[model samples]
Target: MTIPGGELFDNRDGEGRLRVGVLISGSGTNLQALIDACERHEINATVAVVVSNKHDAFGLERARKAGIPAVFVDRTAYTTISAYNHAIAEALDDHAVELVVMAGYMRLLGQEVLHAFPGRVMNLHPALLPAFPGASGIKEAFDYGAKVTGVTVHFADEHFDRGPVIAQEVVRIAEDDTVATLEAKIHAVEHGLIVEAVGLFADGRLEIDGRKVRVLPER
Candidate 1:
């Protein structure tokens, strides 16, 4: 099943909620946040599954605790990067996932996987992207002594954190702030920013034009 280019996402799950698959590589605090939002009816979606590239990822435990399917896809199991991406996409497709969310999955997916989902992959970044675009965002921002930093949620293309932004929330950097303090603030905003972005997607309210994403008025 391949999504055609220029197609907007439609939440076609019969359950009346978008079927979402979350990808993670660590503790999955953001995954927990998504789970909480879904349980509280804060979003019109359900996490169909949680997949981790790391077998020891705590996010798998989080998924199991929530009675959700948890899977581990080891990168080394595949000989090629494209093959690995295809494997992950295959799992999401198996669950009939309508929305694919990268909640800290460390690997970059190639066109093989992105083509499967098309414009439906979502990602949350720990910083205001176009500024801090790598793994250690909080530390980089703090070490550089930036005044304001925040969270960004966006569509995921092949590029790393360079997709059209969906939402961003600013966090004021205090005069005497440590990396830990900045990280806490960034995560707090990430938990909500990602939920809001996914909520917009679940409602089929996002339109992507070139590199810009316009969130349409909620129906």
Candidate 2:
């Protein structure tokens, strides 16, 4: 649970707002949420960059439309996962990112990216983690007949969806709900929770200790 050399960034002086680099691999719903929050000034951070593993990801187009710097780091071009992650880390660093948010980023990040960002990287998972950790989380919950499922926003560790929990929002699964229905509800919660968590982070209201997250009172 211990993140190596975890030092929280200081935003008290307001020299500049937190700069966030978002990574996505799909439709980018959550990416859109963050961008909207930044535009509305609901969060004190800006989307400094957006990187995608796939060149044709719709998220890249979203970023470009927002006028944010977007990069495509293809994993197939790299010989190893570590190399690809190193390139991702370099891209984030190049933008002077203070935080990295993974929204529908399918690839499991390597140790290089984890070490490079330390406690700075965050990810949103469809299911309440430690329950369904891998892909197709909504389908997993539906197959298992779970009555209630939720969304989890957590730090990005070397493992998949195994990082410390930051925030979570629960959603009820009705008996009539199919996988798609459940996924839709999950996405709704994911968008709102991610925006809220990013605002808390930008305001320096989040304190991480081990696997626990403390939301301090706003200043």
Candidate 3:
């Protein structure tokens, strides 16, 4: 995975909160978690906007209810992936987004957005990444008879689910647990771990050194 190389200035808003743009594709349970965290002041940030490629995504409704701007950039309207991604980047930039979080977004970000945000992009995966990647991670882990699977929050790179891991929490698979149960367990962990990664980034505690990430002490 190639890291998008560029320096990004601190784009905190006047209230000293990081401005976040979250991209989602589905129900956006994770998006809700981030919104809740911001509301509760668990993180020093605010969700400025939510972007979705699918117009009917429930995440858009979630964003609307939160009073955050919800944008649907129709992929069908663009001929090339780069064009679609560029539109997404434009939307984030319009909101003064400091951090881009791919909560449940289905598409891989292109260079247009990557170059714009660089190390400021993050993603949450269902299984311990570099392991079961892709849309069906929870099912793959269950079918593989893995005893322990977990959630991973990492910096987004060019490839899918391949980037510097920021944090992970393990979920033990029980003998009685089915794929559905395992998925539930994974999502529960995801909600917390993703928020933790975002909080670390918001506080300037994450330092990416090659494939490694160092979580610095709080000031």
Q: State which candidate has the highest lDDT.
A: 3
RMSD of each: 3.0, 2.9, 2.9
Higher-ranked by TM-score: 2 or 3 = 3
Better of 1 and 3 by lDDT: 3
Residue 43 error for model 3, in Å?
0.8
> Which residue runs of candidate 2 sit more than 4 Å off their true CA positions?
1-15
| CA lDDT of every candidate | 0.86, 0.86, 0.90
Residue 105 Cα positional deviation in candidate 3, in Å, after optimal superposition: 0.6
All candidates' TM-scores?
A: 0.93, 0.92, 0.95
- Residue-level lDDT of model 1, residues 1-219, one tens digit each, is 222221233544555778889999999999999999999989888899999999999999999999999999988999998888889989998898888999998878778878998888988888899998989888888888889989989889989999988888899999988888888888888898889888888877788887788877756
**Candidate 1: 10-residue stretch with minimal lDDT:** 1-10
List clash counts for every candidate, in order. Answer: 0, 0, 0
The residue ranges of model 1 lying beyond 4 angstroms of the native Cα positions read 1-14
Q: Write the per-residue lDDT of candidate 2 for residues 104-201, one digit (tens) a residue.
A: 99999888887888788999999988888888888998899888889999988888899889898888899889888888899999999999988888
- The CA lDDT at 90 in model 1 is 92
Report clash pairs, candidate 2.
none
